[model samples]
Target: MIDHSIDRDPARPDVGHGHFRVDEKRWDSTFFGRQIGSLSWTELPADRKAGRTELGRIAELSDAAGYSLVECHVGMTDFTLISLLEDIGFRVVDSRVRFLTRWTLADVPVTTPLDGAIRWAVPSDRDRIVELTHEGFTDNDKFCSRFKNPDYFSAGDTRRYFEAWIDSTAFEADAASAVLEIDNEVRGYFIYQVRGEYEELPVVKGILTAVAPNSRGANGHLAMQAFLYHRLGLSDWFLDNTTQLTNTPVIRNHIRSSKRLDEIVLTLYRRPAA
Candidate 1:
């Protein structure tokens, strides 16, 4: 998801004053057919004045290094970076939201899914999962995500992203995935991960989820939530999910389930001018 792998290598102090680093996003580069890079906290300048000058240098260096696109994310309240980002032509493309589930399930009512079944995902379900990945999210969705930006990502690439996400994060420690079956056929899937001691408390994150086009209705979404609430209610882990605000299903679930809005991040993208 958020790629929190920032430069925490004790080599720099405060991510430094006159330093910059752009991590090459290999997956994004290959998927989009262009050199894509991302700026980390290490690249953040000290002040607005330094930011204006340093960020401009970062852009030029990135272009000289063959990066045609660069991305960065900062807290929505970080006005210094926001203004500096705008100075260099970065436009907000996505809003990353963090919704926290404090404890037990909220007092929201959900419709029981008709003929829907849920089970932990197994190796055999890979092919069916891929099939859904390709067909589940379509143009008909209220909104998909950062990957669905047609100006930069093709529909085919978007599907590949979902496939890649599941493949890459499926077996990490404490990761669990569930598949939703409708009428005895696999129609949706979601991944959940728990960090036993992340941030000094057990933290649970909703990694991602997808439902087949045939099952994108209220029943399908509620079924997944029912499963999530069931699992979350079992432990006292600090549960949360970072999703695009435009993702209607998740936003609805947050409101319906009473998940508090804890944080909001703005993801900005800048493409090299042709």
Candidate 2:
């Protein structure tokens, strides 16, 4: 079940605007002060007509609740829902590519020496981690596009999400984090899950990895990832990374390292609540 705490404040009848179980397994949530509603689910409706109709209902409800924005990702197989969403008001924002591999320690490459020391993060490093993360991502194509289009994306909201995640939690639970230090200063960081959500499959996933602003143009991000992957000794894992189609440098790095493309998720956004 999805968390319902986000729905308690300024409560409305469980439907106005906040996290809610839209249906059994399907859920929706409000973010950025309940101005944006996002529909997500563990298993979307299988039948095309049913899927489209269900999403349409969610959109209608969000509109009535004064939501200025709504967004969701429909898998390629659910193109019908995409069309249905477009028919109302949603437009494509960006596409996310999921890469998967049965990664082994042997796959790590030895190249230019990473001039930094990687170590476990401590409570004191929380503020630095958040700052470096924002700096690292500010120039990224994805963040740039989102910053330019506030109606569809909230860059501030994105930053806050990462800030909360990096604020000095113990690093050995479901998720783990590490820092790259150069000359005794934090220059880069990486976050990954130690185990997959599904125990049966057990896939390690690298979630957020980044380096500080001045460190751009260097291979710090890639090097940090390689070091973490080697240290963790991941046997199989997946990394969901996305770059704007025009961001050639990062795209090249992704293609060179990825073993397989799992699926491309199209992000659709609707503005003005209609």
Candidate 3:
């Protein structure tokens, strides 16, 4: 048996390491009527056996919980563990790339709409926002596959996931949910949260942003970006952005605006209840 001391490394910051968990809520298992488990971890015990044992335990527990599949997120730097996971039957599904931007007053664009438009979302906007979210994420990076495998994932599942997000974001006090209105109609929306601290500097994170497919050319996206940057820039906050690797449009836009890629994550999956 491997010593548990690996988790208490004195040389590494307590928060630097990652953890593995089964997030049932995020996957909409109850709504979808399917048990899906998410496995994530940052550091592995030096004892490979222990790491494998832990993963095996997770798989077993997921099976017991009636999970049909287990999704695992592995960072690029953790190749050793990746190889181990692959050997144990997990196949890569999708990948995520994390980008970071240090927003300041200087980074704010002068072209952003200065009008007193762009307001926080209200209860009346929930249905439309959910619809927009469902449409925007149908081809999301996490499950972006040309195979069109409904058994693995479906548009209905995507809608359910966003429904949960909208429901939860509405109740989060630290969250900022905003929508762009043109001619008194919502065209785009964004969800952000004030999270994390580095050297006491606050971090503003964008959880989701989407423009109605039909409204793409109306500058709704730019308006949303400009509004958030200007708002966060006022506090000299650092910005964290994450997107799936297949989201070329969003990635290209961020890069064009000077966002730097910080990390790449690979999400692998094992099916048939482990």
Candidate achieving the largest lDDT: 1
Tell how far residue 259 is off in model 3, in angstroms.
1.7
Model 1 misplacement above 4 A: 1-20, 26-34, 41-47, 104-112, 138-141, 171-173, 196-199, 213-234
lDDT scores of the candidates, listed in order: 0.70, 0.60, 0.66
Best by TM-score: 1
Cα lDDT tens digits, model 3, 7-39, are 223442222212344544333455567665566
lDDT of 2 at 61: 73
User: What is the C-alpha lDDT profile of model 2 across 130-199, one tens digit per residue?
Assistant: 7876766643544544433656446666665556545523264666677778888888777877544442
Better of 1 and 3 by lDDT: 1
Q: Native-vs-model 1 lDDT?
A: 0.70
lDDT of 2: 0.60
Record all residue pairs in model 1 with backbone atoms less than 3 Å apart, i.e. clashing. none
Worst 10 residues of 1 by lDDT: 8-17
What overall lDDT, based on C-alpha atoms, would model 3 receive against the true structure? 0.66
In model 3, what lDDT does residue 268 have? Answer: 80
Cα RMSD of all models vs. native, in order, equals: 4.4, 5.5, 7.5
Q: How well is each residue in 221-266 modelled by candidate 1, as lDDT tens digits?
A: 5676667657653545577778877777877878796788888888
- How many clashing pairs per prediction, in order? 0, 0, 1
